[model samples]
Structure formats: structure tokens, C-alpha cells
Target chain A: MIKHKALLTLFLSLFAVSGLFAAKPVPPAKKAAPPAPAVITGLTAVDMPYDAGNAAILKWAVNPADAADTFYVVYVSSLEAGGWLEADRFVSSAKTGKDVELPFWAWDGSSLEHAVKVELNNTYGDTLPGSVFQFKVAAEKNKQVIAESMPVSVTPVGNWFRLDRMNNLVLLITIIVIFFWAVSHAKRKGLFIRRIAGLDAIDEAIGRATEMGKPIFYVPGIGSMSSISTIASAFILGEVSKKVAQYDSQIKVPHYDPVVMTVCKEVVKQSYMEAGRPDSYREDINQFVSADQFSYAASVDGMISREKPAACFYMGYFMAESLLLAEVGATSGAIQIAGTDVEHQLPFFFTACDYTLIGEELYAAGAYLSREPMLVSALKVQDFGKLFVMISVFFGMICVVLGAKFGWSAFVSSVLNLFQNF
Target chain B: MKLIKKQIPLAIVFITGVLTLISYYVPHKVSVDYIETMNKWENIVVAFAFLLGLISLFFSHYHKITRKADGWGYSIFVFIGFLAMVVPSYTSHGKQMVDGMLTPLGWSYKYIYTALSGTMFAVLAFYIVSTAYRSFRIKSAQAFVLFVAAFILILGKVPLGQIIWDYALGWTGQGVSAVIEWIMQVPAVAGKRGIMIGISIGAIVTSLKIIFGIEKQYMGKD
Candidate 1:
């Protein structure tokens, strides 16, 4: 009983100290008077190129409230002669917010007659107009003239695009031109594209799994349904499922997105029906895991381990999880074919998978498998566009080399300009 | 009836495509309104699509858990986690209940999913080293050249390359760095350009065939 009482006393003392340690309420700070308006902070004026005039940018800071009803009256004076003359007027209230830009007439810099002045105002009753002091900017009765900031000198820089940034534009145009050229060339010549060995290998892979009496596992990537890479993956899934159905081999499609899972089920079901093996297809074959990135990876990894499928197909846009999924399949001694557009993850896949599809090859999977004429035709056009771009690049290089000595050949410059402008 | 059933959706799609294309050029208030309407329609469609995903998820997992298949415990974990996320999301409450709840839950999700899963991926670093050590052996003269080029590229990308050889730093020299850039600019870009060209042509032809009814595979076999 004595020990229990002492323990209670100690607990009470600890509670008291915690309460004391709680932060003290901070005192309210004193409010400063709202700032006076029209304190000009910046001025930029430059001589207009190929013209007799100049352009200037004037900036000033004002009370957030005063900006609602203020107007700046700009005045100019010759530095040789002290008196100032009115040059331009800018109203602040007409635009969206506090910031306003005004255009003023250019003054020749040779004339010392270059000084600017400004003013601020608020709306009041009729006949209440009064002048506030020029320099002080503060007056009596809650109205005060704000002090003017030191005027800044303006330097004129013409509005011109940088040469370096134009290189990126040139590159973009070249890419587009090349893309179109290759496409057109392919279309005109009826390019006889060969069948991708990796595609024929899919059937062989599925057949081996069937022969071995083991199920096949397929992951359509961790990307959402809308991604092009994921869509391509779905197309491949359709083809794979058809093959699996014909072989009478069980196939599992573990999905990251629910919509993708539904689509996968439809495509799988359709493929089975088309292959005359509808009875062999199971709805359970296509499973929807969580949409959360890591959760989905864990679920897929779990599915792979428990199923221990003979063959695994990894197709879609993948991140860091690419290696995790591929490595696990490798460990299971399964033949893995992985395809993705993510360049950085390619090395991981190349090292892990039996067959790897590079960037645009993922898109080509449908064409390679289905041999649909439409797909082949489209690829042909894209090839032509690429060729066109390459030829243009070479031609432009030659022109630029020659034009360097001829003082800007118009034709060469124009072609270069098209690339630069594009 | 046929027109209403078939042509109406086609018409809607066509109109939508045209309007979307026109909106890029139109800068008018009416065009802005059309664009806004399209955006709102898309948002609503997306929201409804999300329900489809949710249902599929529940159905998929519910079947697994109820059947007591292998790893049903994981399904139960998923179901519980799904409920945990869904409950707080719909609970109309102050900042603490909604925002603060995600902190712990997200961390748990990350720990279970990313970090542990990433640890599995860390094996790649070792695997790559081992794979390179084993498979990158040179057998032929051509293989030797390829191997040397690969070595230079690997060296040039890392910081240690410049430390080992200053020539690797020169922009104009025909050093390893310059060669790597040339390879990327020439061969890599050429291949990419070729692929892109082929894809565009393929897409256009495919689209035309689909429209003209020349490609009927997508319509489901009779």
C-alpha cells in the first residue's frame, strides 16, 4: 500500500512537469500602418531597333488596397533643365489586378531631359480633390503621400529568340521530318517487314509450358489503363491468352488497375472464344490487385510465387518494380519475355529476362503477332517519314557548310530558319 | 434505328474529335465553354470508370478470399486495407481524420510494397555485376570491338571516367565521350526515327482500314 502511494505521487509530479513544458501562448504583434502608394522600384527603357524611338518598363510597389484605385502619371524633364514635363499616363484599375504595364514614347538618351514622375489617388466625394506633396506622398486625415523610390535607368534589349534554344527546335523539326519521310517511303515501296522471332517464340513458350504441365503467368505492367504502353500490353495479352487457350494451359493475368483487369478479362474471354476453347477460359484467370504501386507489386509477387508458372510475360510501362518482378520469375526458373518503353529500366530487364522488347518494339507486338494489313501499312508510312527527316538533315548540313562562306545563302538560311522556327 | 444505334456513336466521336482539334485554334469564349464542357464530361466519365475498377477489384479479391485459395491471408489483408482506405475517404470529417490517417497508412503501404519489394530488386545490382562478369567475355574479333565500345560507354557515363582520363572530358576530341555521343546521335536516333516512322504509317493505315471496314478482326469473329 505504501509503495503504490509513492508511485501515484511520482506520476502526478511527472504530469505537472509536462503541463509546464507546454508552449506558452505567443503575444500578438503590433500592426504597422498600411503603406503609402506609388513607390516606383524599377525602370527599363531601351532604344527601339531600326527606329528613332525607345520603349520603357516602369514598376512600383503599392499597398495591396491602394492598388485598387490608383493611377500613375509619368512626367519627363531634361537633366540640363530642372523642371519636369508630363510624358504618359497609366491607369491601374482597368486591368485584372495590381500589376500594370504601360507603353511610353521614347526619349533620346543624348538629351539630359530625361526624368519620370508618378502619383497615386483614391476616390472621394465631388470637390474634395487636393494635391499631396510630390516627394513625401503623405497628407493629413488617414490620407498620406507615399515616398518615391529612386528612379532606375532603362537598358534596351530587343525581343529576340536565343540561338541556343533554337537548337532544340531544330532537333524537334528534324525528328518530325524524319518520322514522316520514313513512313511515306515504307508506304510507297510496300516494305516487306520480316516477322519478329520473339513473337513466334511466344507460341513456343506457351507450348513448352503446356507440354511441361505448368501454368503460364502474365503481368500487363503496373501502369494505368490509359497509357499507350499499357494498351499495347493489353493487345499482347489478347494474343497470349488465345495461344494459352489453344494449348489448354492455364494463364494468370494479375492487374494493377481494376479497369485493366476488366479489359483483360474481356480480351482473354474473347481470345478463348475465338480460338474455339471458350470452355477452357476461367474468369479467375484475370485478377485485379490494388491500384497502389507497391501493394500491387507485392500482390503480383505473391501470385507468381504461389502459382510457379512455367512462362511469364511482362509487358507495359514499368518503373523500379520491373526488376523485382523479372528477378522473381527468373528465380522460379520460368522463361520470361519483358517489354517496356522506359529506357532506364531496360538494363535491368535485359539482364533478367530471356527475351526483351526494346522501346517502340512494344508497339510492334500487335503487328508482329496479328499480321493485320492495316498495322503493316501504318508502320510503312512512319518509316517513310523517318527517311525524309534523315535526308533533310544531310542536305541541310551540306548547305550550312557551303553557306558559311557565302554570307548567308538565302535558300540555306531559309531551310535552316524553317527548322529553327519549327 | 440502325443509324441511331451505329452512326450516332460514330457521329459523336467525330464531332468530339473535330471540336477538340478546333479548340486549339479558336481562342473565343464559346470555344472555351465547349472545351470546359468536354473537360467536365471527361471528368465525370473518369469518375464512373473508377467505379468499374473498384467493383472488379472487390469481385476479384472476394472470390479469392471466399474460396480460401492459397494466400487468402494476403487477400484478407488487402480487403482490410481496402476498407481502411475507403472508409476514411468517404467519412465527412475535419483535416485530421482524412489527411493525417494517410500518413501512417501510406508509410505502411510503402514499407510493405516499395521498400521490401525494392530489396528484392537490389539483387539486380549484384546480378548485373555477376552477369557482366560472366557473359561479357569476348570470343571473336567483332565481339572484342563491341566489348571495348561497351566498356568505354560505361566508363564515360560515370564520374570516375574523367578522373581516370582527362581526354574523356574534351567535347571536340574523338575520345570515348565523343564516340558515345556520336553513337547515340547517329545509330540510336536513326533506329528511333525508323520505329516512329513505321508506327505512324501503321497507325494511319490501321485507322483507315478500321474506318473503311477493311479490318474486321477487332469486330470479333463471327
Candidate 2:
């Protein structure tokens, strides 16, 4: 009885994998066989990395030669759910032709790798957390399943960390770590930020203003409180107001924002207090003009013409009003020192102003002026970061040259691809 | 007072800032909703700020008029202008934006504010010409180069420039337009990109500083 049971088990096992064990006889050549649909060469499902689970990347190679109007019903089979299941995923796109809902279109047919991410959903349209999911893509033609993809599985998972964006995160952490490290080290050693010429000219400009007894006109940009440029301007304002307090030079700050006015008052007052001349600080020196841009420009122009301020500081964010203020200052023969993050406007400031800090130099102004160890370290780290970028740029240039001149473009591209965030 | 001055504001900034930072990485529902809430709060604060701004302006102008200080005569005009803008809005019930031309407030905005604003913008055109003349002067080698570039740009834009180039070159190569395109697409773009990269890095570092509370100069203290 045991031998008979064993024989039956062997027979069932052999029957289960009969195709693999023994080939079927070629019956009547091709006449008896029905015409099968186009073959799906490769069926692959990879876990869609860096996603919030419930999705699996399904890749397949389809015979473009036998392209016809047929819907490819895509599904994922996972044992976690009962058996085979359908999903409502993010990358399901349907555009006319086959309604396969391809995530992307193939520009080239033969060389195309059709990769789609199938999202698994429950009965109630909600994302199912990643499980061992296998892809089963079928070509349905005329209400019948004609061709089916080979059994291949890809389990969608929610990665706690995005491996693709690891490079960027690492670089950022490195920069911050280096910056703080430099800050702490410099704090001990005593940091020194190199003198910025534009900032250096501030003292001379203020002295001229004091000697002439002319008020110094300052425009803290048109932007509201959220702008970094405006914030940088405020930091610089603290420094400038201190100098104004020292020389007893009148400083006029016409504001574009009311909130900025409040902030500037505090900053100016702080500066005066720090300078030990708190009596010189006045609220009238910093007041909000009209919020209207052109009106503000007109008023500032009028003030510049009438008051004839000996020096003008057009710091922070600026727009079309940049050239207007700088030009009037130039014509009035006031020493203008302008620093802003706006690059396009830099040319205008450069032409019309006595000195202009280009782009990042505006951010570096506080450090340069304060020469505080903490701020100086930031500038130093920025310089170091710039050096790293410059080195990368140098290599990038060489790679481009070699890629263009020689046929070693693939290796260069591969290297470039590796450095990308994704 | 301590809470308002230090604790409460800092707490708000920290909580809101950290949430916003997290939202960039996690594209989940909760983060998105929280960000939306923060945006709503921002709008409300700005609205209140605008209201406060109006009051501040009134007080400042009032002081100037009452004191009869330097350029005090200008204060009366400001009051007159304020009334001119406000009275119409009052009549229009703050529906000036969508109110028809028949409404006095809308009419004032259309006829007066719009006209003045347009004129101001128009004046910038003349200023640009004057400034360009000063900027593109051929004094030094640098100035000479700038002058040449300016000449080419001006020539490339106008029809006369293309005509001159076409006549001179005789179809042997591209017209002034091609040279202009090359200059803009290559050298100009290169310089712009460099400046942009520097600005982006500065912005990133500054933002990190602000986020980490290392830089708090804007908070009205050291």
C-alpha cells in the first residue's frame, strides 16, 4: 500500500510539470495549432523604491511588430492578499491606442523598455501596503485573453529612506557638518572674514554724510518679511545703523513693508543701543512709505532729489526701482553702495552705484561686517562648498569635451548618471 | 510679554518650520494638510498686518501734519490722497475690484491710480535709455567691450541691424540674429547660470541657518 501511494504521488508530480519533464509530440505540424497572440518577451516586476508602498514597478518587452488594438489588463498576484489582485496605482495612464495605461510612451519601439508601476488597492479604494506582488500582464483581444506575460513577481515596499536621493542628503549633511565644525573651530581660533570692498566703503560713505550733514537714504527692498534678501538687509541695517550712531549721521530708511518697518526700528534701536548712543535712534528715521511700488519709487526719487543724501545704501531685494534709485543717487553724486541677491539687477547697481556686491556677496555681508566666528565659519564653509562644486565643474567640463570629441561618451554619461539625486 | 517676545513666536516658528521641512520629504496626507493649514495662517497674519499698516500710516502722517515738521506740507496731500482712495471704497462697500466703472472708487482707481502707475512705468523707459548710455560708455577697455556688446544687442533686435548684417555678409553665414543668439545662448547663459548657482547655494545655506535657529537676526535680536 505504501509503494502504491508513492507511485501515485510520483505520477501526480510528473503530470504537474509534464512540459518541463518531456516535450509533447509534434502533432500534425502547424495545422492543428491555433494562432497565438504576440509574445511578451520579458516580464519583470521590481519594487518601486522611494515610494510610500502599495506600488510595484512592472517591466515587460512587447513585440511592437504585432501591434494591434488590444487592451493589456495588468494585475499583481500576491499571497498576502488571497491570490491574484488588481490595484489603483499612481502611474496608471490611459491614452487611446491599446489602453494598456502605460506610465510612459516609447519614443523608439524596438529599443523600448516598457516599465510601469502597478499600484495595489483594496476593495475600498485605498492603497494596500507592499506585499510580495507578482506581475501578470495579459493582452486581451476581442473579449478574450490572447497573450499573457510570464509569471514574474515584484513586491512593492515603502522605503523608510530614499536610496536614490541619498547622494543629495549626504552632500547636504556634509556641508552642514563642515560648516558647524568650522564654526566651532574658528570660534576657538578666532575667525576673520576678509574685508569686502563694498562694505568697507560704508564707513567712508557715512563719514562723508556726517561731514555734509546729509541724511543717508536706505531702501530695504520691496519684498515683505519672508524674503531672505530683506532679512540680510536687516542684518546689514543693524551694522550700518551702528556706524550712523557713532558718527551722529542721520539715517533715513523708507520701508516698502509695514512689518519690515517694525523690524527695522528694532534693529536700528538695537544698533544705537549697542553703539551707546541710543538717544540718536528715532522711529521717524524708519517709516513705511506707500505700499504701491511706483508710488514708492516716485516718493523715494523725490526724497533723493530734495534731501540730497550724501550716501545711499540700496541693499536687500530690488526690482525695476533698482536702476531708478541708483541713477538718481549717481546723478545726485551720493556714494551708493548696493548689495542684493538679485543677479539681473546687479548690472544696474554695478553701473550706477559706487560699489556693488554680486549675488552671494550680499549674504556674506553680515559675516564680513561682523567678523564674528560663527558667521565667518559659514562663509568659509560656503567657500569650501564652492571649491567642491568648482572641482566637479572642472571634471564635468573635461567629461563633456571627451564625450564630444571621442566615443567614450557612454562611460562619462554613466558617471554623470551615478551622481544624480535619483 | 515673555511668551509674546520669545517663547510663543519661537515655538510657532520651530513647529511650523520643521513641519514644512518634513513635508518636502514625506508626501503623505497629514504633511500636506498641515502645510495647507500653515498657508491659511500665513494669509490671515498678512491680512492683519495690512490692517495694522494702514493704522501706522495714518498715525505717521497725522504726526507729521500736527508737528508741521520738515516737508510737513506734504502730509496734507497724503491725507487728501488717502481720503480720495478710501471714500470711494467706502461708497463701493470694498467691492472696488469687481465694481463697474460707474462706481466712484473703481473709477478713481481706473482713472487716477491706473494712469499714475502707467506713467511711472513709462518713465522707466526713458531712465533705461539714460542709464544705458552711462553704462555703455567707451571709456576703459571694459567699457569698450560693454559698448560693443550693447551695440550688437541693439542691432540684433532692430530690423535695420539684420538688414545691415544680411547686406554685409551676403548669405555666407548667419545674420546678426545668429550671433545674437549665440551670445545669449552661450556666454550670457553661462554667466547667468554661474550667478544663479551661487545665489541658490547662498539661499540654501541661509535657509538652513534660519531653520536651525543659527541665524535669527530677523527676529529683532542677535
Candidate 3:
């Protein structure tokens, strides 16, 4: 009986402990959702100007409070009912109209408006030109949609003219007018071009080669024929070939571009014909070297060292290989005349070459060598263009300074914008 | 023959040139498509032109070998190099990687071609030093000015030179680097801009002359 009483007391104590640890019922806390963000206003979609009818620009006014951690997601749909595709997304503060690169004349570029360019021909196949499309934007914060914009419809059409590039067009037209005027003036009065020492030395170099009974190597450079420098080099080559033929000297042209070699064959042939030495003309004169830059330089360097050509003419576009070729020719004791528009390589040529033609001088070498009225006239046009640029820069600077001093912001901006590439 | 050789080419040049100029200012799809097509054609033509280069290389090297010209042995190596790259490229179907590993052609390019190219490029460093030595010989007034400018430029760029400059001319607030920056920004930029402007004008006028057929050097003599 005593043991039974002790066990009953222990059981009662355990039940009391269990009752103390059990979970108790509590009132459900009042949980409320955060307030919804303000809807974006003035939502509009328009065709992107100066593009190929494949993109639409969506714009809207954003609330100032939604600038941080707020994203604007753009959706595009061909049909208004369904098939909405997420086109692009960006932070609310990004890509304002003021960030658009369009000129002030073409676009207002207001700071209050947000802009997004949506390409229709994206991964989703909505690339039909002249097709109407619907666009809508949604504002989201913390991965939850806070507000949505009304769907706006737009039709992207290809524009014929780029209004933003009007400044460029005007400049081009002015250049064309000046070119014609200079041409007519040149033909009538005969333009005067300054003497270029490098070109004047061409005949002497060829003569030296002839006297020494050694060939003259003309490197047309590694540039393709489409390059302006190569075209200019070809002109100089023609004149040089004529002189070489007249002097009855051998000329070897090692080429890096095959098309240039083919064109050069005709040029050298024509020069020979003009010099009344077509019999002396050889197709082997223009040989193809390796297309690889270093390999080409190495081959030419080897040729210079072996043949020890009395004169070497390095013309056209060159890269790092300029110094290698010039130095080898210098070591071979060849009178080297190098011409290129590559400014960085000019120092190397100036150091290693006997005569170096600087930037515009290389361009002018052909006209200076040939003394043709028409070609010389082009040089005159270039001079006038430079003069116009100088005057404009000086006048623009003065006007800008005065405008800034007098608080003429509009005038100053107009003056500055006139000089901008756009 | 004259009509085919000269007239058609000139006509094509004029049409293409004008169209290209107009395309720059036109935003129409047609203009964009035309440019894209022309670029594609140019790339195709350039690829075909490579064959011409290969043929020319083969014939020239063959001629040199047959003549037993000086360094004729080098010409044989050209064939070896060409075949080394071309045969593997053909076998690999022009794929540089196979099963996440470099193909034989890729190996040749990485090992032989790249190594050779780098070696050749490395030689430029020596040449630069030599060229600088020759250039800064103080032969004339212009040379002296160039030497002074190069001295400051080099001195301002290195740490030891900067320390020396600070020690020598620390009293002035303006450092040698500031002077160098001014020189680069003011004179260097001004000269570069001037050259750029001239080059642009020259390129434009030359293009016009070519389109008008006044510059026929590219087409051979008149």
C-alpha cells in the first residue's frame, strides 16, 4: 500500500510537468499586405527613329520614390489578347530620355521621362516590318509587381532620312560644293602645290638604283586595296614605275595582298607602256609574299639583306613591321624612302629611313609626283577644307566663350552642338 | 572590250559609291540590307582572293626552287608550313577543337605559328631601342627638342625617375607627370587632331575623285 502511494505521487508530478510544457492557443496576429505603388503615367510607345523598322521605343513617367531598387520590365505582344513576351528590363532610374544620344533638334530628351528601346526581331519571332505591336511596362520591387502601365500600341516604320544626321549632311554638301569650285579654279588657274622633298627624291633614288645596277624594292605594305593608304600607295607606285622604266632600272614589288598585286601588275604594265619600255615589263616584278604579317616582314628583310637593293621604297599601311623593314633596309645601305599615314610608325621610319613622308604628306605624294591638274585640284580642296575647319573652330570657341560669359545657355549649346558628330 | 573593261566598271563604281554614301544618311531597311549584302559579298570575294595568293605563293616558290636561287631551301619550308596547316584543317573540317581538345591544325597554330609570330614580335623591342638611339643622336635643333621631350616622357613614367624628379624639383607644386600630361593632352592631342582632320578631308576628296572617275590609277592608266 505504501509503495503504491509513492508511485501515484510520481505519476501526478510527471503529468504536471507535461502540462506546463504543452503549446497554448494564441490569437492570430493581424498581418496586413504593404500598400501598392503608384501606377506609371504617360505610357507611350513609338517607332525608334533612324533605325531599320525593327524596334520600338517605350517611354513613361516614373515616380521619384520608385527610383531605388525598382525595376521596369518591358513586355511586347503582337496580339493584344495574349502572347506577351518579356522584351527587356532595367532599373527605374536607368535610360532616361536625357540619356538618348539624339541631337537636341531631333529629340526633346526630357529628364522626367524613362525610355526603353525594344527590338522586335529578338529571340521571339516578331520581326515583321510595318506590323503593329503592343507594349506594356510593369514596375516591380523585391520580386513583386507593385504597379502596371497601360498597353500602348505602335507601328515601327523605316524612315528614309535620318534627321539627326542633318549636321553631317550639311557638312558633306558644303565639302562637295567646295570640291567643285576648287576643281574649276584649278583647271582654269592651275593650282600650286608645295614641293615635297620625299617625292622629289624619288627620281634620284631610281637613278641611284640604275647606276648601281641593282633593283629597287617597292613594298606596297600589308594593307588591302580598299584601304585609302593602299590606294594612295598605288598611285605613287604608278609614278615610281614610270620613273624606273625611264631610267631602265629593275623594280621588284613584294606584295602582302593578292588583289593589290593583280591591280599593281596592270599599273606597272601601263607605266612600262607609257614609258615606251613595254618590252622590259615583266610580270615577275610584282611577286606575292606571305599574307602573315611577321612572315611577310621576314621575307622582305631577307630579300633586302641578300639583294642589297640600292633603293627601297616603303609605302602604304604598316604596323609593327615598319621598324623591322626600315632597319633592315638601313643596314643594307639602301636609300629608303618611307611614306605612311600611320602616325605611330612615323617615328620608326624617320629614324631608319633616309626620307620619311608624314601623314597628309603621304596622301599628297601622288599628286606632287604626277603634277596632274585634276589630282592637284583635289589637294587644293583639302587645303580649303582645313582652312574652313580652322576658321570654324576659332569662331566657335569665341562664340562659346561669349555665350557662357553672358549666360546664353541656349546659344552656347547650339554652338557646341553644331560641332558635335551627331 | 573597252566597254566591258572600262565603262561597266566605272558605271558600277559610280552607282555603288553613290548608293553607299546615301546609305550612310538613310535609315531605311533597304539601305541597311544593301550594306549587309555588300559586306557579305566583300567577305566572299576576300576568301576567294586568298586562293589567288596561295597560287601566287606556290608558283613563286616553285620558280625559286627550280632556279636554285639563293635561299632556295627556305622556299621548300613554305610548302611544308602551308601543307602542315592546310592538310590538318581539311581533315578536321576547319574545326579548331575536337571533343574539347585542340585539333592538329590548332596545335600547329598554337605551337608553330604563334611561337614564330611572338618571337618575331619580340624582336621589335630590340629594334625600338636601336631606333631610339638613332633618333636621339642630337643631330640638330629638332633632334634636341625631341630628345628633351622623350627624356621627360621616359623620366615621368618610371618610379625611380619620378623620385629623382621630386627630389630635384619638389619645390614646385607641379610634378613632372603633370608636365608630361599637359604635353600629351595639349600638344600631342592638337597635332593628332590636325592630322586626323587632314586625313579625313583627303579621304573624302579622294573618294569623290574615284567616284567621278577622275582618279583612274586604280583602273590603270587612261
lDDT of 3 by residue, A1-422 (tens): 99999999999999998888785867799789665455789999999998878888888885787748889889988753457889988888898987777777887877788988888888356446337899889988888988888899998899999888899899999998988888788789888787889889998899999999999999999899888889899989999999999999999999998888888888999999999999999878998888899999988998899999999999999999999999989889999999988888888998999899876777777888888888899888888889999999999989989998999986887777777886
The DockQ scores of all candidates, in the order shown, are 0.10, 0.36, 0.51
Worst 10 residues of 1 chain A by lDDT: A102-111
How good is model 2 by TM-score? 0.77
Best by TM-score: 3
Chain B TM-score of candidate number 1: 0.63
- Ranked by lDDT from best down, the candidates are 3, 2, 1
- Model 3 TM-score relative to the real fold: 0.89
Residue B133, model 1: lDDT of 52
Interface RMSD of each: 8.3, 2.6, 1.2
| Runs of candidate 1 exceeding 4 Å displacement | A1-191, A405-413, A417-422, B1-39, B83-150, B153-222
Please list the C-alpha lDDT of all candidates, in the order they appear.
Answer: 0.61, 0.76, 0.88
Is model 3 an incorrect, acceptable, medium or high docking prediction? medium
Clashing pairs in model 2?
A134-A153
**lDDT (10s digit) by residue, model 1, range A192-308:** 776666677798889989998988888888776656677678778888888888888889887777667766777888899989998888777887666666666667777788878
Worst 10 residues of 2 chain A by lDDT: A101-110
Colliding residue pairs in candidate 3: none
Candidate 3 lDDT tens digits, B104-134: 8888888989999999899889888888888
